[model samples]
Target chain A: DAGVTQSPTHLIKTRGQQVTLRCSPKSGHDTVSWYQQALGQGPQFIFQYYEEEERQRGNFPDRFSGHQFPNYSSELNVNALLLGDSALYLCASSLGQGVNTEAFFGQGTRLTVV
Target chain B: AQSVAQPEDQVNVAEGNPLTVKCTYSVSGNPYLFWYVQYPNRGLQFLLKYITGDNLVKGSYGFEAEFNKSQTSFHLKKPSALVSDSALYFCAVRDMWKDTGRRALTFGSGTRLQVQP
Candidate 1:
């Protein structure tokens, strides 16, 4: 089966610009989560979407938001982006909202804010 | 709040030698732990997870992790390291109590493993 897929493998945007990254979760999965991975760092949770609603969010600012569709695809939006926003955006998918479930990740979208 | 810590920034080991990447976690309740490996310019690949059962959890690519509840640590181990096994390793956790309605993982800073041939 095709795993989680993310579009726009690489992107470049100027500071203050807005960016939207897309993700299609693995088949048979329903929950999608977004994370940010800076250079030389691990992935940081941004937020999680389940049942088309944001279920949980990390410590990130309001500038970061996301949406999940009926097809289990997701979109991560960042407004008023700063240079620090330049990082690899990872999309993960799981079967349910359970701690026992393991998340499958996408290749990630590398966003470069100039 | 739950958190994970991978104390080592990098781990160097020779091929055929055993390797260990340390990880510690903090959670208000039972911790669901996980280990992921990332290659250069790639996403996190799930290696293994510890939900319950035995302390030893075996995962992909000849890797295993030992969960020590008293120590609150989950350390990834490999019996014999291979050069191709070199990559960035991350430790993640979810607090069972905090995951009542939401499930978001708390990740460690990651540890780079370099297995020299």
Candidate 2:
């Protein structure tokens, strides 16, 4: 089965510009989560969407938001991006919101802010 | 709060030798632990996970992890290292009791493993 897929393997945007990254969940998976990985650092949770509704969010600001479609595809939108927003945007999918479920990740979208 | 720490920045080992990448986690209540490996320019691949049952969990790539509750550590080990096994390893954890509706993985900084001939 096709695994989680993310588009625009690489992206470049200027400061204050907005960027949108897309993700298609793995086949048969429903929940989708987003993470931000800075250079040389571990990924930080951005938010999660389930059943077409946002389920949980991390410490990120309002500038970062996400949407999940009925087809289980998700989109990450960053508005008025800052230099610090330059990072790898990763998308992961799981069966449900449970501790035992393992998340399948996409190759990730590398966002470069100039 | 849940967090993970990979003690080593890099691990070097011979092709035939055993390898160990250490990881420690901090989380309240029962913890769901996981190990993933990433090759150059690739996404993270799930190696294994510790949910319950036996302390020893075997996963893909002939890799296994031992979960030590008292020490709050889950260390990944391989009996014989392969040159192709070289990659970046990450440890992650999340509390089972969190009300956050979705399970989020708290990842470590990652440890690079280099296997030589």
Give the Å shift of residue A68 in candidate 2: 0.2
Tens-digit per-residue lDDT, B1-117, candidate 1? 678999999999999999999999998878899999999988999999999999999999999999999999999999999999999999999755344555678899999999999
How do the residues A1-114 of candidate 2 rate in per-residue lDDT, one tens digit apiece?
999999999999999999999999999999999999898877888999999998888889999999999999999999998999999999999998888999999999999999
> Which ranges of candidate 2 are over 4 A from the true structure?
B96-102
Tell me each candidate's TM-score: 0.97, 0.97
**Residue pairs that clash (backbone atoms under 3 angstroms), model 1:** none
Window of ten residues with lowest summed lDDT in model 2 chain A: A37-46
Candidates 1 onward: DockQ, in order: 0.88, 0.79
Candidate 1: which docking quality band? high
Model 2 clash pairs are none
